[model samples]
Target: MAAYLKARIDLGTLEAGNKLPPTAALMKQFDLSDNAVYRGIALLKAEGYVHSQQGKGVFVSDRRRLIAGANRIKGITSPGESIHHKLSARVEAPDWVAADLGEGECVNRVRTVNRGDFILQASQSWVHLDVAEVVPEVDEPQACDPTWQAIYEQRSGNPVGVASKTVDARITSAADREALGLDADFAVLVMRSVYVTGDKVIGVGEGVYAPGHPLAIA
Candidate 1:
C-alpha cells in the first residue's frame, strides 16, 4: 500500500499540497483494514512523502529540489529568483563556527532566505570582522542580487576561487521548523559550505533546507 502511494507521489499523480483521500476511501480502494491503511500512511509520513494537518487531512509534501555545484562560489538561488535575507547583527562566533573561521577572528551574520511566501533556507555565515565591515550589507537585511558571489566581489573586490560543501541529514530545529513551515519530525538537509580565495577561508555558510527539497549537484 505504501509502495503504491509512493509511486503515485513520485509520478506526480498526487502532487505537492494535494490531500490524500480519506482513510475509508483508501481502505475501500486497497481492500485494506482501517489499521492497515493508517499504517501505510504512517510509513509515508516517516519517509517525508506526506504530512498530516489537524482537521484538514494528509497531503503530499513539496518535492521542489535545488542544485548546488560541487564547487559552488555563490549561494544557491535560481535565475531571477528573488531571495530576501534577514541579516542578524554581528556576534561572537559559535564554537563550531569559530573552529572553521578561527576563534575570535570571526563575526557571525545570519539570514533567512525566502522566495515570496515560501521559506527556502536559513543561513548563518561567518566572516572576518574586516571583511564584514568592508561589505557592510552583510549586516543589512535585504534582497540578494541573485547570488552572494556578485555582492561580495562588488563590495570586497575579492573573488571566490573555490568552495567546498558538505551535505548531511538532520532533524529540524524548532526555530527552523517554524520559519520553514516544516512538518513535525521531518528531516532537513544541512549544507555546510566554505568559500575560499587561495588558502584563506573567506566565508563559511551553513544552510538548512526543509524536507522534500533535495539538493542536486549542479
Candidate 2:
C-alpha cells in the first residue's frame, strides 16, 4: 500500500492539494483492511505528504509537492544533524493565525526563504497556550525546529511515538493566498496533529503550508 502511494506521488499523479479518494472508496479500490488504509494515511501524514482537518477532507501539503516526493516523515525527533533546510528566521508572522491555532496561546513564525533568489514561504506553528509556562522557549527550541516537532518531542521523548493526524484540501481563501504569497489557484495544506503521550492526549498542533514548499518530516 505504501509503495503504491509512493509511486503515485513520484509520478506527480498526486500533487499538493490533491484530495485522496474517500476512505471507503480507497479501501474498496485497494481491497485493504480498514487498519491498513488508516495506517497508510497515518504514515503519509507523518511524512508531511498530507494534512487533515476534523470536518474537512485530507489534502496534499506544499512540502509534499516541493520535494518531488521526498520520503521524509514529520514530527520524529533525531539526535543527529537536521534533515530539513533551515528556514530564514525573518518570515513575517500573520495576525489571523490566532483563530487557526484556536484559543489558549499560539505562536506563528512565517518566513520567505531564498536559495540565491528563489523564494519559498513557510509557516512554523505551535499551540497549547495552556502550556506556555511549562515550555517557555516555544519560539526557538533547538531540539524542535517545527512547532509540531517541539511539542511532540517535549511531550514524548520517543522518536517513534505515534500520532494520528488528518489532512484537508480546500480552495485557498483570499486571506490564505495573501498570507502564503500564493495565487488564487493555489490551495492550502492544513494538517491537524493530535499528540498522544503514552495513550493520553498531550496536545494538538496544526501545520499549514502553501504549494511548492516541501514538508520536512524525519
Candidate 3:
C-alpha cells in the first residue's frame, strides 16, 4: 500500500490533504482482506504517510513536514549520556492534539522515554479510527526502560529497516507545559520523524523535549 500511496503521491493523483479511497474501495482494488487493508493503513499512519478520520476518510498528511522533521533525530546524545535512544509505545486519545491529522482531528498520546532520565513526549495525532481500534494495548505508564525495537517488531511483525528524523525548536504550549512537566522557562525541541521499510512507512512521530535536554542536530 505504501508503494501504491507513494506512486499516487508522486504522480500527483494524491496530494497533501487529498482523501484516500475508502477501505472498502481499497480492499476491492487490492484484492486484500479486511485485516490486510486495515494493517496497511495503520502502517501508513504510523509512518506519517497518511491520516484517517472516524466518519470521514483517509487522506495524505504533509510528507514534506514528515521528511523535514526526520532530520531532528540526528544525535540522541544528551549531556550525561552518549545516546539515550530508548522508546516506549502506548495508545492514548487526547483532546489538545495538534492539526497534523488534517484539521480538527486528534491522536493518542505515544510517550517515548529515553533512558531513565530524559523524557520525550508526543501526542500521535494522525492515527485513523480503524487502526486505533485494532490496537489492543493502550495507555502505557511512564516507562523506565524504553525500547522501540520490541514494540515495533510486535506491532507490524517486522523489524525497522531505516529511519529519518527532523529537529526544530518550538514554544512550550499550555498542553506541552502540563504534559512534559515544564515550567515557564523551558523551550522545547520539536523532533519530527518517519520510520520506513522497503515499501512501508512504519512510524511517523513528533516528539517535544524539555529545555535542559539539548538535541544536537549538527
Candidate 4:
C-alpha cells in the first residue's frame, strides 16, 4: 500500500527517481489485487510522491524542497540560522484581526521571513497592546529573539495550550510574485493560526508561503 511505499521512501530504500516495482510484482509482494495496487499508486501520485508514464513504471518524485507545516508556530529556521526579515508595526488593526484580539486593543507586527535571498513566508502577528509593558519586544523589529507565544506566556503567566490552523491556496499577487520569486500563475499556501492558552487567545498569525514549498502537518 501507499503507507508501505512511503515508509520505504522515507527510509531511503526507495530512492527518488527510482522506478517502482511493476504491477504484478507489487501485487504479489503485498498480496494486493490489481485494483488495490492501482489505488495505492494513485494515492501516492496525488500526494506528490510519484508519477506514472503511459507505458513506463512509476518513479519517485524529488524530496529536496523545503516543507512548512501548520504546527510550526515559531516560524521556520535552522538552528543558529539567522532569519532574514523586514518587520513593521501596524497602527490600525484590520477588522478581522480586531475581532480576534478585541476592538482597537491589538497591536500588529508584520514580519516577512526570508532565507538568504529568497523570501519564504510573510507573517502578520497580533497581540494586545496592553501587554507591551511585559513584552516590549513586540513593538520592535525582531531579527532573532524569543517567539511570540513565549512572550505571551511570560506576560500572562500561563503556558500555551493549543494552536489551531487553517490552510488554503491562492494565486500570487504582484507583491507576492516579486517577494517570493514566483510568477503570477503560481499559487501560494496561506496558513492562519491562533495560539491559545486555556480560553485566552494569546496570539494570531497569518503566514503565506511560496509555491513548491512542501507542507507537512504533524
Comparing 1 with 4 on lDDT, the higher-scoring candidate is 1
Query: In angstroms, how far off is 112's CA in candidate 4?
Result: 3.1
Q: Rate the local accuracy (lDDT) of all candidates.
A: 0.66, 0.51, 0.52, 0.66
TM-score of each: 0.54, 0.39, 0.38, 0.57
> Lowest-scoring 10 consecutive residues by lDDT in candidate 1?
66-75
Better of 3 and 4 by TM-score: 4
Question: What tens digits encode model 3's per-residue C-alpha lDDT throughout 1-218?
Answer: 65677545533346568898887888899999889999988887876678887788888875544542223232122233323323333433233222222233222434544435545554342332333343433223322112232344446666543355566787788977765665675667876655444455534566777667533443
By summed lDDT, which 10 consecutive residues of candidate 2 come out lowest? 73-82
Candidate 2: stretches off by over 4 Å: 1-103, 108-121, 140-162, 198-202, 212-218
Of 2 and 4, the candidate ranking higher by lDDT: 4
Q: What is the overall TM-score of model 2 with all chains considered together?
A: 0.39
Tell me, what's the RMSD of every candidate?
14.6, 11.5, 16.3, 12.3
Model 2, 36-153: lDDT tens per residue?
Answer: 8999999988777688977888886755223321233222212231233333232222344333334444544334333333334333444344334445444443323233444445
Residue lDDT tens for model 1, 1-218:
78777766643456568899999999999999999999999998876678899999999885332212321212234333344456656677778877766667565566665667667777777776666666665565543342344456657777663356676888877877876766686788887877676577767778787666545532
lDDT of 3: 0.52
Deviation in Å, model 4, residue 38 alpha carbon: 32
